[model samples]
Target: MSRAVLWTKVVAGGLLMVVGGPAFVEYIRPSDEELRKRYNPDLQKRSAEQGERRAQEFDDYVNKLKHWSKSDKSIWYAAQEELDNKRAAIEAQRAQAKEETRTQREEMRKEMLGEK
Candidate 1:
């Protein structure tokens, strides 16, 4: 090919790359929601499951507490308190997870809507 034609092809190829690279990346890259769901799926279900397990544990502790003697009541009460703390911690964790998921979904929605 002539030098002019060769240079023209090179310029065209460079232009194509410059314009297409970002478009290609955007096309192939997963959206934020997709990435979140892929990495942290079943958030509510898992939280529910954890809550159920904690409830069951609390129930077991209560049952044991009922059967214990007056002398052992102190220990049982302490155990019950510990369970309460654990339940509180779990609730806090669930709330934080939900908030994070909500924030992420909101951000993704904004991105899809072309909002800044």
Candidate 2:
């Protein structure tokens, strides 16, 4: 190529780097906050699912209690004991669920992977 054309190509290449280099980097590199924000919808959906599961579990427990109460007095008393046991079981499950949620939150915090 002629000298002027060669110089033009070099200048064009420099201008392309100046303009496009930063844009390419910006496109590929995600900030921590941006990543977390991107995952917000997934986190919300999971939270809603967990809430629904808890509500269903509560409804099932209530239904079981109601069924247990509709029996003879002795049976009702026995059912009461069973109901107490179920309540205790539910309480334990709640505790476990809380612990699991806490653990998840902690892990997300450490990884900087959460929405909040």
Candidate 3:
């Protein structure tokens, strides 16, 4: 092939690499906002909340480990106590939510039945 034709091909290939490469990457890997838009808002919020909860749990575990390392408490006992505390917290949260729901139902019933 002629040198002119060879150079033309090289320049075209380089330009394609420079421009098309980015376009391809952009299409293949979407931006964070684009990814967020694709999922349901509820799912995104739940995922974020779940991640935060997991991170907090991890931090708590690490802190407990540090404390256990310094103190005379056995790891098994400490771990069981932590689990019990977590269960109690979960039960408290459920109780609070259940009470709130009952309160709302009572209020709605009063409004609908026209009773005090």
Candidate 4:
């Protein structure tokens, strides 16, 4: 080639390298997608373990509340009141059933004796 053309080409090539070097390095750098794929399973396992721990903590708190209901007087009283109400309802039903049975028995006795 001509000397002028050779020098011009060399200077142009050097200028291109200088301008694009940093961008070229960045383009060849490993991507976040590759790094993320490596750690994704470990991240999911940690997240799931944290969720299970949170669930266990919630269950423990609920169990504590249940124990407190049994031990603490106010909570015990509330629970006892509920139990008392249930017992009262059951007793009331039993009394009604007994009254009904007695009535039916009396009616049968009267029919057998021809009293009414």
- Per TM-score, the best of the predicted structures is 3
Clash statistics: count for each candidate: 0, 0, 0, 0
Candidate 2 stretches with Cα past 4 Å from truth are: 1-73, 113-116
Report RMSD (Å) for each prediction in the order shown. Answer: 29.6, 27.3, 14.2, 21.2
* Top lDDT model: 3
Full ranking by TM-score: 3, 4, 1, 2
Candidate 3 lDDT by residue in tens digits, 1-116 = 99999999999999999999999998899788788788898989987789889999999889988876776778878778878999999999999999999999999999989964
Provide the overall lDDT of each model, using Cα atoms, as 2-decimal numbers: 0.82, 0.85, 0.90, 0.84
**In model 2, what is the error at residue 6, expressed in angstroms?**
99
TM-score of 2: 0.33
Error of 2 at 37 (Å): 60
Native-referenced Cα lDDT, model 1:
0.82
Model 2 pairs in collision:
none
TM-score for all predictions?
Answer: 0.37, 0.33, 0.44, 0.37
TM-score winner between candidates 2 and 4: 4
Clashing pairs in 3: none
lDDT of residue 73 for candidate 3: 79
Candidate 4 lDDT over 1-116, as tens digits, reads: 79999999999999889978977998888797665567779896786679789999999878856866787478767667767999999999999999999999999999989964
Question: Which 10 successive residues of model 1 have the least lDDT summed?
Answer: 64-73
Provide the global lDDT of candidate 3 against the true structure.
0.90
